[model samples]
Target: MLREVVTTRYVTPLREGGSLPAIVEADDLGMYVVKFRGAGQGHKALIAELVSGELGRGLGLAVPELVTVQLDEAIAKGEPDQEIQELLLASVGRNLGMDYLPGSLGFDPVAFPVDSEQAGRIVWFDALIGNVDRSWRNPNLLRWHGRLYLIDHGATLIFQHNWPRDAGALEKSARKAVNLEDHVLARFAPDLRAADAQLAPMVTSEAVDAATALIPDEWLVGEPGFDSPDDVRRAFRDWFAARVRAPRSDWLPELAR
Candidate 1:
């Protein structure tokens, strides 16, 4: 389970994101960018944020520390915005939060050049999860303290959004080809071959299990065709494991090699 913290104050809404994730102070005295459960994306977005972010962290990527935030609807009483007030009320329970990075600049390929090795690893990790949001127009990356940090993984692991009744769907999705033409790091000509050799072996069954284990039970509830949250977790674990074992051609961008 993630370390739980209570929201002490709601700072302000980050209007940049469609889901309206906001900056808030937690009881831990640490500021976090919280993704509310009541947001348009729903609980599954929080699930993706936790699972994908943890998976990236496990893969030795620079991802923000994630925490489970306990929100009290009373905090909304001071908010003047009706929309934000309603969102707070709807998200009265558990939500997801990422440690806030102060004054981090949005990643710019020209301003901060990324080496092929690091780019390869990031590109490979994104491909592994079928992330579609890390495009050039909106990289979802931040440059903080001279290091790049990945954020906002709610857009990845799209397969979970439409749980297929077919038992073989997981295996098939694992082998689907990914288009990397628009990936922000594609310009770096990432050596995905080297990235694959160095990183793929590390995504063991144990690692996949560890990543999925971080997801809260409530986030996995009500998933169709699954009897319990553990079942949903098992599905995610199996999918990642299969993707790792799949032929490189299926997922790795040919140009990246």
Candidate 2:
């Protein structure tokens, strides 16, 4: 279960992504990057962020701490920006928040060198979640305190967007291999085969369940084809569990030459 906090103040809008997540101070007195539930991406994006972020953390990746934030429309009263004020009004209630890392620098491949093993692990993990945003153009990676931290997983688990699909499509999409040509760290990842060997066993049913468990029921409610949020949760858990059990060549992307 995720820790919950109420928004104490609306800090500033983060205009990096289309969803327009913002920096806000919580009642806990911690600063966080809050992803609004009413963003264009909607609740599914927040679901992806929670699941994928927690799953990456489960795999020993450096992802920021995630929390559930309670937002109130009145919190935005002092904001002069009309767009941000409207966004805050729409996002009242439960939203997703990530611990803010101050003074963190955006990752620049030329400026930092990543060793092969760690790079391979990240690539392998991204492939599992079908993350498409981690490219050279927009590497959703942050370098804080000399460590790389993954962020912004709203674009992942795309299959969930169109629920109620046939079993065959689900199977095929789940096993689809990721393309490494435009991946930000493709060149740094030389041995994805070794990464599979090391990380595959770790993506067990327990891990999948743990990650999916973090998803809020509110986010899964009213999902098409599923009678209840638990059903949706079970579907996600089973999908990931089955995907990891498949033959490596079926889903794992090869290291770029």
Candidate 3:
């Protein structure tokens, strides 16, 4: 029932792999990426967007705003470009939403020139989700106004599906490994990285509250949660902390581990 503000004017495919996202316009607004039917992951991908993006913002990372959309199967079929039209006709009835990235340009962290301290922070977030996009190969990061933005988190939490029995173990592994990235603080050291383990507690109540505050309850559709998104956030924090502090912990160092 959430109507997307953006309308499809044109959809330029980004690449060959994963969801073939398209560039779209939002009623005279700037451009954004509209993800039509991401091939083969599952509904869990939406969960990542909801949880990770919310959690990242809670951690003070800059993330794009999310808008629930309903793509008209006709948009693809209506394409003026015959080639594109045919492609859409073949793949109809896909759900779509816009990813807003204003005045942004993709850049590798090294190219954008962030210091090791900040790099460690980005690495820390990635480690939590076992995010696979930030490697030297894909490095799906962007830069704008001299700041960094993390993007493309479609392939995370997958360890959950593959290793269901060890879900708790995997979460713990992510938390503890965060401490191993001294390279992040090498130049900045304890000052910048002080919040490493300290973040576990905050992620609980405050972060979830922040995210759910922005999200409407109706969308959740009776998903299990604490009293508030903040409460759910606390669940994540407590769970993460307990795992990290577990003896002979499974956590790997946060970055450069």
Best candidate according to lDDT: 1
State every prediction's TM-score relative to the real structure.
Answer: 0.96, 0.95, 0.68
Question: Between 1 and 2, whose TM-score is larger?
Answer: 1
The TM-score that candidate 3 achieves is 0.68
Off by over 4 Å in 2: 164-166
Each model's lDDT: 0.88, 0.86, 0.53
Ranking by lDDT: 1, 2, 3
For residue 237, model 1's alpha carbon misses the true position, in angstroms, by: 1.0
RMSD of each: 1.3, 1.4, 5.7
Candidate number with greatest TM-score: 1
Q: Write the per-residue lDDT of candidate 3 for residues 1-257, one digit (tens) a residue.
A: 23456465664766654755667676656566655443445434554555567677678787776665444566766778775565455444434354666678877534555665575566656666556566555666777777677676666645334332345664544354333332322332222244455454455545545544543343333445335544543444455445435542344342332
Query: How many Å off is the CA of 81 in candidate 2?
Result: 1.8
Off by over 4 Å in 1: none
